[model samples]
Target: MDENKSYLYDFIKGLWKENPVLVQLLGMCPTLAVTNAVENAIAMSVAVVFVLTASAIIISLIRKLIPAQVRIASYIVVIATFVTMADRYLAAFYPAQSKALGPFIPLIVVNCIILGRMEAFASKNGVFRSILDALGMSFGFAIALLLMSSFREILGNGTWLNMRVLGSWWDNWMVMILPPGAFLTLGTIVGVSRFIQTKLKKA
Candidate 1:
């Protein structure tokens, strides 16, 4: 494939085929912690996309100069800088969400998904390719979070994106909003995803 086509493929692959959440299972902390609602899921995903894309571009540009011994540290610094910006932006414009997301924003500094991309892909690719890879991975992460949150929000709260989906007859499953709920929902989703993958492979 041509360079342009390859870059596009990498970007799109992150959204589904090799999604950071479903496929690689990176950054589970924020994936489970902040995804209680669709809005929070979107916010977290957007923050990740911003930080990952920025760090990937910077890391790709300086990949040759960053010595292997300190490369991880450098990537963390780059990612932290972007995460700080995202945190500040959310705090200023979306205080409620910022409060709800809380420490997860700063916790992005330690998210394996960001660092993994920087070390495994961005550091080895050109600027454009790195950006595309980050975009794809971020999209994948977002989709997984959205799906999980949607399930939890709908069942646990009888709402989807804060809108009532079920009538009063439906008793909310409070477990879905708690930490255990996060695990159960994520576990089920992961199992289903694996099952589908297995069937596809057999076919």
Candidate 2:
């Protein structure tokens, strides 16, 4: 394949086929923890995009110099630096969302999805390719979280993005807003994704 085309392929693949959340099952902690609302999901997605893209760029630029034995630690450090910046930015400008997200912003430092991409893809790829991969992975993560959170928020609160979507007669399912709701929603989504994949393969 042509070099440019290969880069596009790597970037596009993460959005669906090799999605970090649906396919690779990475970074589940924040994926399930902070997605109780659409706003929170969007915030988390932005943070992940900033951290992942920055880490990928840095790691790709220094791929040749980093020793394999210490690459993971180096990647974590790079990811942490970006996460800290993102956390501070949120706290400074969006205090309410920052307070709502709580420790998850700082916890982005340890998100395996970012680190995994740095080690498995960015650390061996060219800078442009790494950026593309990061974009795709971040988009994939965002989409997955948005979908999960949308379902939970809508069903549990009778609202979608804070817009009333249900009738006055509707009784909201309180369970969908609790911790168990996150697990149930994620579990059901995972199962459905697998089912779709299986059907596609069989077809």
Candidate 3:
């Protein structure tokens, strides 16, 4: 019972306490670039989830076999293999999203979030625990991306998932969909989250 509870805590912590995007500030490339639309954000999130989870599992399974001197390189290789699979799969089935996301999907190879988790958690943990950690981190990243994309899409384009959400009378905020918009929106979210965290800590 205690073991199960610990695993649950491991999974839950990533949602807020150690969120990759919002808290850790990792993987910012896609967060700011592909988040102009909800669809793009979803696609990026799915790819990251797949890559991160698979890589964590594989790394945990082979952690002991890897030499300490070359562990980082080995982790990168493992992560890159899964990232290639995700890239090809996205391109094959979701060609539009694949094209929309461009080279960002392939760049997951160097995403600090994946490598950081592999080094900090997966490489040192058991398979089950690593899986939980990966799931938690990935979900945390997805949630942050979704929130950013949804907010930007609604205000910028008056749509959700490319579907109209606001009335025709609404004028879209052009700034909300641009590069600067991503920075501004994410800054605000991080500030608000930090403020709430401080309040909670004080209370």
- lDDT scores in order: 0.92, 0.90, 0.94
- Expressed as tens digits, the lDDT of each residue in 47-141 for candidate 1 is 99899999999999999999999998999889989999999999999999999999999999999999999989999999998998999898899
lDDT of 2 by residue, 1-203 (tens): 47446767887888888888988999999988887889899999999999999999999999999898998888888888899899999999999899989999999988889888987889888998899999999999999999999999999998888889898888999998899999999899989999999999999
By summed lDDT, which 10 consecutive residues of candidate 3 come out lowest?
1-10
Q: Indicate the TM-score of model 3.
A: 0.96
Best by lDDT: 3
User: For each candidate, what TM-score against the reference?
Assistant: 0.96, 0.95, 0.96
Q: Tens digit of lDDT per residue, candidate 3, span 141-164?
A: 999999999999999999999799
Give the count of colliding residue pairs in each prediction.
0, 0, 0
Candidate 1 clash pair list: none
Candidate 2 worst ten-residue window by lDDT = 1-10
Which residue runs does candidate 3 get wrong by more than 4 Å?
Answer: 1-5
What is the lDDT, from 0 to 100, of the residue 165 in candidate 1? 94
**Residue runs of model 1 more than 4 Å from their true location after superposition:** 1-5
User: Native-vs-model 3 lDDT?
Assistant: 0.94
Q: Model 3, 39: alpha-carbon shift in Å?
A: 0.4
